[model samples]
Target chain A: MGDISKKDRIITAALKLFSENGYHKTTVSQIANQAEVAKGTVYWYFDSKKELFQAIILTGIQRLASKIENRIKEEDDIIEKIKLIVMIYLEFFDKGRQYFRMFQEGMLAVIDDNFKNKLMDFRTKQAEFIAKIIEQGKKEEKIRLDVDSKDMAYLLLTMLTSFNSHLHYDNDFNIISKKDTIINIFLQGISR
Target chain B: MGDISKKDRIITAALKLFSENGYHKTTVSQIANQAEVAKGTVYWYFDSKKELFQAIILTGIQRLASKIENRIKEEDDIIEKIKLIVMIYLEFFDKGRQYFRMFQEGMLAVIDDNFKNKLMDFRTKQAEFIAKIIEQGKKEEKIRLDVDSKDMAYLLLTMLTSFNSHLHYDNDFNIISKKDTIINIFLQGISR
Candidate 1:
């Protein structure tokens, strides 16, 4: 994890800067200073700010995907797998709220559009991977046969992406703040 | 439609400048020059750049929300209304993509957290309004009764926020990109 350690350090600094100053406003020098690494070291890990941010975006998404992948791999049943996916998703997000913050708010929006396109492509594959798993569940007849794998995959992703991960806000709505209850309502419906 | 005309012109100019030059880089004078409106006229319509951005965010959300509201308003069926909301949301995003593109990226991260706080509050109210509508649908027994109103509201809002109007991304093939398709997948689920 030597390279990973250095990469992670850079990412941590990048996150703070991005959140505090916006992605574009933050500079390589700032990240280098924060990382306590020399400018060349920063470039050694990431050649440019855009490339560094690309690393961050990919790292964030892949980290979540890896965690989910492992959790799903442990479960054999399709129903159990999906439920686990949802649960683990909220659980991991709860823990990695900063990553979620950056990911959701477009920390890399200042990066080139081509890079954004690549991130979306990465996301697409991740969704397809989930859809395929759901498809397997469908074949087992474990999930609803009529269910659309692709749509479910997309909905799950967008929903997951939308979760702000912060518990408190300017408002006082204790009713809408809990995660377990929120997940329950999502899987089912609120009406009678 | 003079007001509409003026508003449209301002929005158009703002969209291009904000997207390309960013919030700070793009100034009111720049906007006025581009819109071809007198600097005083720009100031008359908007007090300052901050107000202009607030206007941009508010107007964008209002435009999208109004479209969704109109589409779902006629439907008494909660499920149908939900579907329509999804559909109209996708279409609205398609129309306002440029506006969203402008504010959606690195700029929001740079803006004062207070501004975002207000915007997030606005989003909550918007979601609550939809939730109330769904709640009514539940009472009328036209919608499912299992999902929590708050969670459902959050779910819909998240989808809209994260999905860029729920329009299909080329990367996401698991779900239908169109409005009606997502609504169907959402209401019925993939389960046969």
Candidate 2:
């Protein structure tokens, strides 16, 4: 339990620094100092800085996935389920703005192939989750059968992430209104 | 005339290098060598590397804007004009994949406040341009009157960019089919 706590501390500290600075600029030494652990302990806990960064991202993705799973477990309506999912995402990123920033940095940075592959895998899995919901919507006759579920899921997720980033940049925007707009547009589009 | 050619060569070489190796990794000396000009020539044309990058982005945006304007000048139908705009964008990026790559890098990198602000300005202008189209559609009774044109435009542009980046990473995907899917989703959505 102590080891787990220590590792968590390192991750928490590293995430703050990485998000505040950047992946390339943040050093393991700074993470160790912030976490109040010796530099050697940092190395003992993780093989390298890259590994530590990967661990932070993995933990974030897992946590978010579990949260969404728990929130939507009782919801049967496809449209309601999607709304709940979007709300969960907005609230998740709102609280974990640092994590969102780190994720954005990870997305854009020409990091190593391994890191890039991992990010892509995360996105693919995310889209797959939404695609399954879309498929369920189709089965329930709530969604259009002509459109490809996977493609729609991908585009929907893309819009969600993009909107989330916009929220991060501008604080004056109302989240509830924006969320409704997104849902409305996704379901009905802009055409009369 | 000779000086203009030299400057153009430098910009071309810098764009290639910056896209291949990121903005941070590519040096002015390397750009000069690639352009077959003296290192001092690069500095004479631009104040700094950042300025050079800004110039490339500005030039790309202007060129794209002109092409889009020229193509849609005679088209009276809003939907057809939108199709033309999207096609022009796809073709522009397809021909200048290097510029698109550099733009992505610029979007993600925390180079400086000036650079970030400039990118945001470019996006805002693009969104505004799309917003005008949405307004025209609404007037034509082709678009829903309830939606905010600016917000809708912003979302539409975001999806276009996200899809463009996806194309950059994947080669097997059919551009025409994806373009159709995007337009269909934007206009009709996925609901039954």
Using lDDT as the measure, which candidate wins? Answer: 2
| Per-prediction TM-score to the true structure, in the order listed | 0.77, 0.83
Model 1 interface CAPRI class:
acceptable
Clashes of each: 17, 0
Candidate 1: where are CA atoms >4 Å away?
A1-9, A38-41, A104-121, A164-192, B1-8, B19-33, B37-48, B66-73, B106-121, B165-177, B189-192
DockQ value for model 1:
0.28
State the weakest 10-residue window (summed lDDT) of model 2 chain B.
Answer: B165-174
CA RMSD per model (angstroms): 4.8, 3.6
lDDT string, candidate 1, B29-144, tens digits? 88888888887877777767777777777777776667666666678766666767776666666665555555545344445677767777777878788889778877887666
True contacts kept of each: 0.19, 0.23
How does model 2 fare in lDDT?
0.73
Best candidate, DockQ-wise?
2
